[model samples]
Target: MKPYNRRLRILCLLLPMLCLSLLRPVPELRADPSAGASTDDREILQNSLSVVEIDREIERITAQQETIQQELNKLSGQLEDKLLQIQDQQSRAGAVIRSYYMGEREGLLVAVLSAKDLGSLIHMYDVYDMIMEHDRTVLDAYQSEYKEIKNTKLAMEKKTADLEEMKSNLIEQRARVSALQQKVDQGIASSSDPEALKKMIEEFTLYWENVGLNEVKTYFNALASAMNDLPEFIQNQDGAIRTNGTTYNIDIKEDDLNAFLRSKNDLFKQFAFHFGEDEITASGQSGTLSLEVQGHYSVEEQPQNSIMFHVDKLVFNGYELPDTTCRQMEEEFDLGFYPQQIVSFVKATEVKSTDKNLHVTLKLSM
Candidate 1:
């Protein structure tokens, strides 16, 4: 008896069906109330699983396109090399021809002048004539070969161009797939946790201008610094460490870890907006949003001065906040917050250390 890998078996069964689904044009829906309900239900189904399917298709298509592009690029490079080689051969042939025919002393004249005796002069003339004839033959052959190579190169270039066009079309298709996937994913994410969605939007507004800042390189560097300070923070009660009064155990798996990273990245986008030296405006089919900081110092604004700040710690909703006397703002607004939910800039303090720069940790509602 063989062990069953259910997911693999389902995927194998659905492979053909999935391909068939892609071939059919999407159907149109009626606009009645019942039709609207059906549409909503269908949307939920798409949000749940269609987005993942679309992502898988996109990955497959993108990989195929990349492979094709690499092959086309290689063929184009080889064709270009062949063209250069042909041109070089032609140039060498031309130089040989010029030497034999266009020099001040022709081959015949040089041979006659160099020969000492009559028989030797006759043999030299014959040899010079034979050499010139051989050179002509070689030049003619090279020209013919060069022409052939040129024609072949043209054909290959046409083929490469066709492949590139095909790749471009495929890339466009992949973009469509990616956009659809994002829409479905967003819908699912929104339905699952509206609070988290709001947090993502708010954070995206913060460091929106710092697309470069969200790089893995910077993330890793920041993470390194944070990790290095962990020991000292854990030692002191006033330090950055937090304790739940009991042993804290997490139940996250690998997939959850990946989701956490994505959520973290989204959170990073929120921080990026806070550092906004300049306003960033992005408009998509779904919506338009803008992020800007009101200050004299604009980082991307190319201002003369730009303020730098570091986040010390994050405060989520309902946590024991430093300002115990302060009222919770979200409660007044009737907005509920949750764990891992990012909030707005509450009261912050400037680092009293040497630099005297400001550092803020956003306060969130749980």
Candidate 2:
């Protein structure tokens, strides 16, 4: 059998199992299947295990922080209640003091001092003294209440500030958890599953090559078409290429492509295509495009071989071609081109390939 066919057979045999491994819940550290494996496999296994450990640690910290937050929230509620009570007591104390002083000014002293005779005068004096003493006692009670209220408020404020600090810590802790979760995800992606990773790598490689090829094709086409129409700002030359219904002059030097390609960066887009379907499943910013790629076949005739593409980066020139319509075609078809109609120029920097579907991301400089 051909090398390709043999590779395809191995891949078909291994892929489903590899996918199952990926899908399975990350193994426990002690029970990890790769624990006793070869050196490299053990390294990868240890890395995966470490990620799982970090993720688990993050979760634990998050739970602990959540518990602390709940405590803080509960304390906050209590503080609010205490503050309100303090305010209420202060208000009541103020009202009591106000009424007592107002009433004192309103009468009893003058009434008592104006006693008619001897027996009445003595009784009135005693009554006035008793009233004065009662006023002093009320004032003392108010002062004591005020002091207690003030002290309680200070304590509550301190508790509230501490709770706020704890909440901030909790937020920071949760962010750490989220960051760790992402790391774990990446670790899973990087795990060296040869059969599964192969297709994606091949696809990325091919797609990048395609990006460069398509961009060059597009630029040459546009230049040949717009030679005479170009403004004096752009130097016009005789080197041209022809495509359907158009003659594109290559006014820009060949080295210019290097500059444009260098400046242009690539953005990778990923996609998946199942065995039975001709259509590719993809997600895009604008909308989904219905892409159909020709099938890659194996010698054994068993749909065993598949290719996957991933665009690592996209790089391109910032210059716009004169033909705006063709420029749109470049974007719509994921070709590399500049159009007067487009807001910016795009390029692909890196590309990768695997043995299932094409994925590409083009970087645009607007």
Candidate 3:
């Protein structure tokens, strides 16, 4: 089916099934920071960049999955047809074997061998040639059919696996985005005094411009260094690993990451990161400031493949900053990464955080 046609069919039902979020009334703002989250507890209700962008990201992933599914279904149909072809080919091959065993083929061979005169021998040889031609045609067709089915099945398996992985990433993305949206809403709710909030946002923005990028990069660099600690994918650009397969996974334990980060950066000596099921939360003292950060890894396909870790929620010195501050910080800084040294070998496609580890998915390429 055409994409627009599927969209049209879905659109037809939109009126009947209105989204609950659309029906939701505007929420009243709460002045008490405790109403949403707490500053004393180091829980910061930081705002997010356009939540709509995250929504669009979800839609894009869903659409890509749907397209892959359609291809899988088409392959399934082709596989069915190929199976039928194989059955027909098998039956033809069986018939030829049965005829050969039943003496029809042997009779021709006997006559050809027993022929005495040149004329008789030539005639018998012609009959034998005709029989051989018939068998050869059946066998050749069967071989071709077998090859075709094998290729199709391999392609189907690859597509199925890719779809499943992408689906898992999609689910994780939705959960993380939902958490980010909640943070944004909470940030807005905590904005009791706009003038004071504006001043705080300005101060935070200035701080990020002056110090955040260097500190965050140092922290992120530490995380990247941690990737090397993983047993798998710890290879040179031209390493023997993943030579046959085009994709690989890197899963690092939470404790292992923390240990490596602290080792890499002394500022993170007291820092700790918790890789949740779908999000990453960290809090610690870097310099004299105690910072609490909420973030997630989002994959980017354009301008080269990379995973970007964004601080969608942040609390610096026990203040819940608004989206204005977060946006400026985000515009100037990016914390996530890919193995640049491996760019000659592979590219990262997706990432998902689990309670056990941060899972990065990469695809090998020239």
- For every model shown, the clashing-pair count is 11, 52, 0
lDDT of 3 at 47: 35
**Model 1 ranges off by over 4 Å:** 1-40, 43-57, 76-88, 99-133, 148-167, 182-366
Q: Which tens-of-lDDT digit does each residue in 1-366 have in candidate 2? A: 699999999999999999999999753222112223455533433333333334444455456557656765665666566666656566666765787767854587677778899999889888878866766766676576566656655665665676567567556645654664465456446767655433433343243234423544444343334322322222222332212222222223323332333333221122222222223222111121112222221112123211222222222221111222223333334322222222124323222223232222333433
Best by lDDT: 3
lDDT of 3 at 360: 73
**Sequence-dependent TM-score of model 1:** 0.28
Residue 199 in candidate 1 has what lDDT?
Answer: 45
Candidate lDDT scores, in order, read: 0.41, 0.41, 0.67
RMSD of each predicted structure: 25.4, 25.6, 17.0
lDDT of 3 at 87: 100
RMSD of 3: 17.0
What does candidate 2 score on TM? 0.28
Name the top TM-score candidate: 3
lDDT tens digits, residue span 220-328, model 3? 5565555454333344223223333677766656776676667666766778899997889888875445667787888887776777777778665455544434454
User: What would the per-residue lDDT of candidate 1 be over residues 150-249, giving only the tens digit for each residue?
Assistant: 7766766776676677567557655665675677566646665556544443333232213311232244343334434322332332323222333211
Point out the worst 10-residue segment of candidate 3 by lDDT. 28-37
